[model samples]
Target: MSNSNSTPLMARVTLGRALRRLRDEVNHLTLADVAATLSCDISLISRIELGKRNCSQQHFTKLMDLYGVEESERDRLAELHAATREQRPPWWARYSEVITAEYERFLGFEAAASEVFEYQVGILPGLLQTERYARAVIGAGFASLGPDQIDALVEVREIRQRQRLWDSDQPLSCCYVLTEAALHFQVGGPQAHQEQLQFLLELQERQNVELKVIPYAKGEEGAQIAAFRIFRFADDDVPDVAFGESVAGSLTMDDPRDLRRLHRLFSNLSAAALDPDKSRDLITRIKNKED
Candidate 1:
């Protein structure tokens, strides 16, 4: 089951999409039609369908009645509506001082994801990063923060790894496509870098984790793309979301068009990357060179 505390937004999105589908495909109704039926402004209906606003209990029941929704489907949507209205604080709520709201939302998605597809150009993904490597990366990126803040951020990364990768009953299935340059970047000096690569090797032994390296020979296949991850959930109602990291902040998108483009880009990168065994060999060779 998806963790409700970590996935309320996901539920909201699912409910919104379902409402929109019912309005369009089933009833063939327009926003104006829904608005008129509910006796509310069209913008209210639009925002509700877009997941930007919550549907009130009265409005929700009225919409269900307006659409002539069947009992079973209405019950399911009601559960999703309840989930969206849940007020439980996420596990990362304590770290609110250190992380942005956008990042907190990403964490929520990550915590609820069953599988993750990631592509990195210059560094290891957080779930695969060693503590020291994480500290170094966080410290550099958040250079203005004090040591305590940096340590707290590092703790956040460690907690994320533990909850999603190590401690979960069903560990998150992960496929990572990384550029060869990622292995060579040496984020936390030679010792920490070496440890990070060795850790990657060990992680490859796990059934849930798969790592592939895009050799330098592959050139710029993934270079043009910023680091990004595609998160897939177990629930079909909650659509897959793509997250991109940038200097400014993180961006999350669930638009089908954007998802299709990202999917195509990831497919191309994966096809151009080295296979698992060879990718492991390349990592080992690089680690040896670090000695």
Candidate 2:
């Protein structure tokens, strides 16, 4: 609802509608038929038809072939996918070389998200990261990337940060819950990490953004094991999604069951984490400790 101007959602909806229309025209395959072909569940197929799940590249390809779609239509769908991935880097930074192919895909989806909710148990999400911090994290994580690749990746990352300008028909709204340990973890040395925390404090004041903290003392309840981000599209038709990452790659889930699980986790996290004012205070405390 916030992104009344965003075209990505509309594009997604248009694709879903087209997919459904094509299916209907061909004696209408049951959910089972699509699921069997995609190696997913019937419910997932239903969600995809309803525009709740993002269409994967492979799925798009298969569907086009199956429906004998016209070249023009295929091209339009492809354009939508590419447009959804486009981003403008920050004026001061560049893309990162350490970024893997999977993360890049996730970043593309993030760029077009109408709203994002993140639960971070370790480090800050990339959107809230500063150039220095992001560089340090990327460089340390992947020592193999050549400087050229790293530079290119950093530029891409900076461009992705322009999600701030997200002003689609459904503007982006983001909520983040950061763990206390992430504050004192001392990533990129004291100064860079401190600045990152400070940046988070400033970012909290922006419209449509909310930052909360899960203090160390909160114990088990505050210790949500992994980090995940949920992206919700603006169009009424598209389904919401949750993305999870591991050391090597990440996975995206849009199944109704999976989405429901993530939604519940977010609700619990929001309740357990500190409110905005308190979260800001905690970050300030961490920054002052550095001083």
Candidate 3:
């Protein structure tokens, strides 16, 4: 069995997709064929292609040769494989006990994303949330977690914001659409909520950030849609990913059909939302009302 962690790493996912595509579209090879060449079981090939199992170096090289991957592409795939074998854990690995494997994967994707389109309801998106607001939200949502665990998760959020949003040399372009109700919801009580709105106003001034709000008057425009985010990577080899979460669990979808649906949903929501200038105005109005 290939030595691989149970948790899916972002590079592994990308590599798997690339390999799968090459198998299906480029090489027109079947699992059985590849397995026979490697003298391994078809299931093993399937798992490696699905990213559930890591591809060994021998198999990787053999597959690349079989696929007739271009020199440049071979170099890229080699780097991805090397990344999968990285000895150092990601920054969020310390909080692993507190966060789900899926969430950890999400942090990796979000960190690497070049752009993010997020639609949120009920509360502000994590990137836009204030520390106190995040604390309250995390505490209430994860009531079973101990105080320390909650604190660790909050710190993870702060680190994510700093690295991805505030401190990055090329900060990811972010487009956020939130329901008006999110602004009105007093998540961390009046003071924290007010601060959160003020922070939103400040973030709106950022060149790479775009904030919009869907007012109640818009009615059902975005009412039925759950919160979700679409992450776009700079690497053309990696496809865009659509992620949604609820109390049940989180889901990550990269199928072209799903991506198209989410893109359409986001486009409609953006159309229905207030423009950035008006969004700032409404947020200011709400903040003043809180005071």
Q: Which of the numbered candidates is closest to the native, going by highest lDDT?
A: 1
TM-score versus the correct structure, for each prediction: 0.93, 0.72, 0.92
Predicted structure 1: lDDT: 0.88
User: What is the lDDT for 32 in model 3?
Assistant: 90
Clashes of each: 0, 32, 0
Query: Per-residue CA lDDT of candidate 2, range 1-291, in tens?
Result: 224213444455556766887788664777678778878888866666655567778888888887787898779767765543435442222233455556654664665577899988888887778889888887876688887776666666666676443433344688888788888887888888878888888888788889899998789887776788898866554567689877755787867799999999988988999999998998898899886
Show the lowest summed lDDT stretch of 10 residues, model 3: 1-10
Cα displacement (Å) at residue 243, model 3? 1.1
Order of candidates by lDDT, top first? 1, 3, 2
Question: Could you give candidate 1's per-residue lDDT for residues 1-291 as a string of tens digits?
Answer: 355324677777778989999999999999999898888999998878767688899999998998999999999889888988988877888989998978887887898889999999888999999999999999999899999999989999999999988899978999999999889998889999899989999999999999999998978675756899999988776788889988887888888999999889889999999999999999999999878
Better of 1 and 2 by lDDT: 1
Model 2 stretches with alpha carbons more than 4 Å out = 1-14, 17-28, 31-101, 165-171
Per-residue lDDT, model 2, residue 55, is 77
Candidate 1, run of 10 with poorest lDDT: 1-10
